[model samples]
Target: MPRSFLAVSLIALALAGCVTKPRPPSHLGATVTVAPPSKADVWQRVASAADAARIARIGSAWSEGLAEARSRGFGDEVKKEALLLRSGAALARPAPTPGSYSCRMVEIGSTPKKKVAFERFKPFFCYVEVEGELLTIVKQTGSQRPAGRLWEDDVASRLVYLGSLALGEEDQPKAYGEDPARDMAGVVERVAPFVWRLVIPYPRNGAKLDVFELTPVTEQPK
Candidate 1:
């Protein structure tokens, strides 16, 4: 073979060898790579199976706590709070103006970090005047996917029970009267990003319900 051709063939063979060889895995977690070339060569052992199990447990605990709260007469409070947290007080209960308004929690997304975090969703509502001027309002909440559905074996099925329990607690007096939010306020505050409340509005007219979301004002950046 000619010297130039021989050199070219050698380069091609080297490139082929490089291409055929499998690359080693990185030290990062199972997420493949955090930086560029975000592809998985091999799943990393960032967290143990136990860790995943625990993470799942945390979500389960949250759901359980919510259920317990419902059983404790905080049903309206919890749903309203979820709505408030997902939406806002202004839109949630409104000012109780003569114009009738009805609001409810559309979605609740929470992110439970080690110390602090957030969960945001939407509070969808329909407000109408006695005269029949109806309006539907959908408010946007912040971003935070909190851990709550760990035990939800069936999202759709459990949601029915959850919806009934979370939203409707009229017959279940014991569940409706207990204040789960108030009971878990301290625990939630310790782990949650802000001060959480399980507010059962005064007078108990049952016409209005909500969970008041309160966050301590942080020092503004200079």
Candidate 2:
């Protein structure tokens, strides 16, 4: 063969070998590790102190108003005030004490072995008290703001209490429904010193339930 032709063929063969060589197995080769998703990945922390205060104020005001109306014999005025409080412009609550906590809703994947997935229908807020019951506020609809009426209307928020913590039980709102008497049962487990998990049963049978991992945005000294 001509020298030039021989050289060209050698280069071609080398290029072909380079192109056809199999890549090393990824497990045996250098690999990139990905961190698994955790509660932090899904749950959003509520950082707005003002928002927390506002919710607190609304709850307080509603309680006060209800008591006053009952004492003064002001019928329907309590309802009127509740309506006003919910529809009126924003109002601020007093600053939350140091150690108070607030939480925001987070989206997460459905549990692995369930036939159905539970859908979170509204935004939720949790307030941790230093010495009393833990307060939770859940909106009935996306349009509802964190106001007195929203608190009053939602059974979940209105009835949430930490009394079960003493008994080592999960506290949830009273389940009220038709003949079958559907109610939500929840269990609270401590994942860490500052992290907790809320496990609630799905309303429908054959559905995958979701567990909410809660992290405190504000931690008070014990």
Off by over 4 Å in 1: 1-44, 57-59, 83-222
Top TM-score model: 2
lDDT of 1 by residue, 1-222 (tens): 799999999999989888866556765435653653211111112222432343334344445445544554556655654433321222212211222222222122222321211222343222222223321111112221111111112122111000002223232212211443311110111113323222222111211222323333223212
Q: Model 2: which residue pairs collide?
A: 116-208, 175-183
Q: Against the hidden reference, what TM-scores do the models get? A: 0.21, 0.27
Candidate 1 lDDT score relative to the true structure: 0.28
Query: What does the lDDT read for residue 76 in candidate 1?
Result: 69
